[model samples]
Target chain A: MRIFETPLYPYERSPDQDAAAPARHPVVVVGAGPAGLAAAVDLARRDIPVVLLDENDRVSYGSRAICFAKRALEILDRLGCGDEITGDGVTWSRGRVFFRDRRIYEFDLLAEEGHRRPAFINLQQYRLEELLVRRLRDLQSEGRPVELRGGSRVTKVEPAADSVLLTVETPEGPYRLEAEWVVACDGAGSTVRRELGLEFVGQVFEDNFLIADVTMKADFPTERWFWFDPPFNRGQSALLHKQPEGLWRIDLQLGPDVDREEEQRPENVVPRLRQMLGDDVEFELEWISVYTFQCARIDRFRHGRVLFAGDAAHQVSPFGARGANSGIQDVDNLVWKLERVLRGRSPDSLLDSYDAERVPAADENILNSTRSTDFISPKSETSRLFRDAVLNLAETQPMARPLVNSGRLSLPHVVLDSPLQSPDADGLPGRTRPGSPAVDAPVDDGWLLARLGDRFQLLAVGIDVPDDEPGLEVVGLPARRHPLLDERYLGGAPGALYLLRPDQHVAARFTDYDPERIAAALRRASAQETDDS
Target chain B: MTRLRTEPNIPDGDGFYEELLELHQGRSKEESDSINARLILLLANHIGDREVLREAMKAAADTGL
Candidate 1:
């Protein structure tokens, strides 16, 4: 059987199952999806015990999320699986937008040269999960305190003042677990969120999309091709993407009122594919499903001791590939704060920054995806008129090219007005400003981000080297080492010092070397002190 | 930073108005709406100054009211 078809981590009764008292862990991740696995791996890497519970033993059944963006890949690199994923996935940066029969214009998502990873990669969700599971197993072999229990369903969640009680159901029997903190990454149909009586509040788009993953020997280049009102699917949009193997992902708009069962039938889907791909092209359907997405998120991610991450926290339409990518970002933002709080290194209130920062990120994702959805599936006649007009003008007009919204593809959202970020003191580059994730550049040995690793670091660019401070790792790089580094980090300034958070987001920056300011920013970032400025 | 000029700016105002009406003469209501949308988009792109566009949009929105 294929890896996804086989049980990778079958249910085995744990010692906690037979204990007279419920065994407690430092953290209990309620699902083994990408967010949960990343959270568990991060916790274990920090030497914190984590129990990852999942409802199934295998990876995701189908190729659910295929597009992994660069920021998500960078986060995976910190988790020790970036090279494996980028190596096994099909990388592409160019996307062509089609209006009816003719191509309107194309865009390169990432035009810069110094980045370590590409703009995006198309890998089967199962394969990505397999890689993460392999990483989890590797962590296990290293005597890390992380456990993956498959076939374990979290049936109930009860939050308390200091702990959360979970009732999990398994093949053997139902058992209880108490966790100091619980992270729910149980996907859109989240059981934990439901049990807590919380709902994702936002717009539910009125459209259906049929996804058909086909294996073929076609010679399509590795670029994203999006169609608006195509000939095959009149008055609708379609998407074609290349995957790692011979498989290709084709999404066709089925409108809002499609009969899901009939539309997903191979008889109806194959003819549509033939019309789009030409009649002589031979292919076989690998998996087929119809989905209607919602751009929504919960009110707050943190609910007392139980925190929600991934789809349980928020969800966006899959057009921009924001769903899984943002979910991975959610965990990346979450795990660091959680680890610090669990280690008694930071106050519990520091976890509140996760909500403050990520909720805005979720809102940004929702806004962008909702705009893309409205453009692709115009809600009213007036909106459709404007959308078509832009497309009509985009045929020959370069100005109209930027107006055509074929799913404003996913990019990392900067955390704006965040409390963790210190206000900009010197006029450095805005791209690497406080609250923006660190931009990767070439360093002495390898990439800049690879050296930054997953910790609080003081990056001194084009300036004199500083000795390591109490809790921050000091990294000094000369401006002459790389011109792109100077362009990205220093801009017009002579030199700069940046205090980077554990997630490699800029906490603060300065033109002069002031250890006092850097130390205060670190304290404020960890919630050890209040921001006075 | 240009403000929306409420006073006449086009040198040949009637001629431009006549030309605009002539462009929509043979079009249906839906076609006119589409053509107007395309025209607005073209003009908006040409005038890439966002503050001027914002002022023009506000002036247009408050015209009848």
Candidate 2:
């Protein structure tokens, strides 16, 4: 009995087709996945009018992208969907890695940190998209300048000098749409990317993996459990994760030369599941699919008026849960820049920093995912030998435990040497450096992240920022020395001031408050837009 | 420990070789060499043992020559 439910929304052809003149929106978002929905919601919140188009009428059917990292949840929080998501999603921050039958180590991602959100949550992608859809509808009901049109497949894209022209095919007929900027979030085989003739380049593993979501009544704890070579699943790697609603995602490694069609059959899959969980453990399959991991990304995320995001811009192996989490981060990075550019607060070239910043983020994800794939499915005999040696030594040696690579789990990547950041002076804490996402800590009655509230602010940790700056929002956190805060934010010092971007990433930090550097960084972050409004 | 126990490590050597070939699919020799150089350093750092690394070097050198 498959338990996952997918309901389709009604899709009607846009009335704009027969209008007297084509309606021009400030932003047009293609695809309604997490990335596109996130982009739409973020833009709408910024008072930008947007039209969201998707070919399909429903959320994702399967329990795809189950592990949502905290950073993504924060981004979703900003878009008004985080509380509902984290409320229902199973939260976990610890995992165990096993080599063969023996458990080598148990790792805790955040050992001791008091924050509003947990380190991670396990909810199906459909559940996530459903929540986002509800949020979009709420915004729509409130008359917030967001239009979501389903079953509108973009058939053709023409990139002009000023704007991009689109031809979308709806059930009624084909219609022309134009926008000042097009956000191509139409996923991996994106029609918009194809129309532009852009290439996605990188590594594709030859081996196939079988991912199955099953519903069962078992007492499996909600921790990511991985095995390199397990007794039950003979010689190949296996991963087990518990999603909400008693659903579990199982990934079993299928080596090269597998008959993928035969492997995916329920008869074949059920037996493998029985072997992995014992024969007596009853379960019914909800969804099953076969996939090959590829670590590929485009050279740039921005192209003229058409910007690529999510799977359209980059893709990685599902090893580290980087796929959707990084995609959400991509949306987070792009939306602010897009909003600034749309508001005329920043020049159009400010959009280029999105590419500069997120390309490196995508590359980091690709590189890590590629390494995890190589380790899990070792590419050579020598590499496998080395992997085995490390796994073997990991049992007795603590140093070898760190060397073991069982999907180095997703962490929010800090932008290294971003041109938008003000350069760091000597002796500042590394946790919240320029271009790094501000690490959260406990403030007076709530979490520090809840206090940040998604705005460009001058943050004064453990002290008060001098008043008198008109445009800057100065936040003062009292000097109460918790160990975690001291180590991460203060670095055993009393106070430090930080200039933060709207995304809560540190733009600059200093021991002494300097208004000139802060002003300079604000200008650089705005891509040299010097006019003080 | 057994000195240089050379057995099949990856389940399918040919498949893994295919992946390696695909990694360098579109790269020139120079770019591929540079990639290999970077990979060598990275893997060497991971291994971090003088004797085993020496054995690996000799085995790899002995293969092509």
Candidate 3:
């Protein structure tokens, strides 16, 4: 019989006029990890409605990442959570490396000056998550609530010409969510990235390492310690970091042939740690797991309406503490742009810059972390020999110190090719240009791109505003405070001005800060309106 | 106790000496002296407070190296 199947339900129109309107949220964030949470908080603070969904019921347990760089702390400060985090976290001003019982090398993170904060701080991942969750909840209490749905697993994401449709399942039932933008922060095994059919290309290390969290009563120094060839295991190495609550994190290299199940047992780890500690101290086992390093990044971070951040976009080895810090920066880069787009102040192409600026940063960080990994834990015989030779030279030669210090590592600052930055005119060295250091400049409190302002701003430094510069606000700096100026220019005063973006990245710098040039540059940077004229 | 002279070329302070220890078990006289000099400077930088910086510099300068 040719019977037409009954439609699921007759479409009923609501009496309300808005019922017929298409569903369009300002922003939709997939995954509730640090990256997604940070994005949601920033957007919500800007009075933008955000739908943040995660598959897990609560923050994931186990110490995923513990170290945060100085820049990351600056970001947290802007988000209004830095004080709490810094107060709770341990600041390691120094670290030491050992070869068996003898001390080999040491690093001082507090080498540079004018750092608004310390170089690095160590805090457990769970504590960070707790702080973020509390802050998000507090924001919700203030009326500008971020819509966070836990256990609402997203199964399918289809990007439309103007928006994105996400099919999510929850305990109540299945529902469809439509968003003007979608951010996928679901982590390394990201379903959103896979469904989008993006390629995550890079290298995966062959060697596996065991990470053990232990409760210890030992009297070891509070500093982070690395042992190259400690007693018991030659060639193989170990990393010991002190965590809060009298806990310690130990990373030990496991041979390829070692049995994962056997080595993971508490019995195996306890003895190994004891061997390293000698007969002087006592400790108890807490948690043990094996992790393999991978240096991979998505070729394209954003595809149409779907955007990726954190481990979903890129991942690096944990050598230089770049993995989590970079992910947080990704959120910092995107949140402001997403806010502008949602507010209809800018076009979607604004999202493209996120990819342009961050992808290169990710690649550079990966390369750096890989270099550190290879040097500390050489994979090949040739690399091992080379490292040994370099160390030997550094021992005898006074000039070889910076090379070794550089090898240890530092996080990189972002430099962009936007229109806001002034072009390099005179061949001056080590000067603060667009995307360069703001070390010597006099930073103001509400001066947009001033010192420790964690948001992007347009700095019209050292410029006299002509009558025509109305929409743009300009701040003038004298030559004495602004060291980047050429001595010959502006009668010895630094005539150059810089336009800093919200993320502290310089979009453009100008030698003159001419009203017409500065306004045009700001327009180009905000991507607000194309400069056809 | 033997003293080492500060050299102009080296950048980091005694931290380099500590790092050198990681690479080589020990070094020659020249290496030890230079590393000590670098360490003193690095520590001076770390004590960024002007008073602290000066104190560290004075201590290093006065030490028999």
Question: Which candidate number would show the highest TM-score if scored against the true structure?
Answer: 1
Interface RMSD of each: 0.5, 8.2, 9.2
lDDT of 1 by residue, A103-128 (tens): 88887766578889988889988898
DockQ of 2: 0.04
- What tens-digit string does per-residue lDDT give for candidate 2 at A347-414? 98888889989999999999888888888988875677667777776676666677677676688989
Docking quality of model 3: it rates as: incorrect
Error of 2 at A334 (Å): 0.8
Writing each residue's lDDT as its tens digit, candidate 3 over B30-55 gives 55554555564455445546765665
Off by over 4 Å in 3: A1-23, A391-410, A416-431, A436-496, A511-513, A529-533, B1-65
Model 3 Cα shift for residue A240 (angstroms): 1.5
Which CAPRI tier for candidate 2?
incorrect
Provide the lowest-lDDT 10-residue window in model 2 chain A. Answer: A1-10
Worst 10 residues of 3 chain A by lDDT: A1-10
Error of 3 at A479 (Å): 6.4
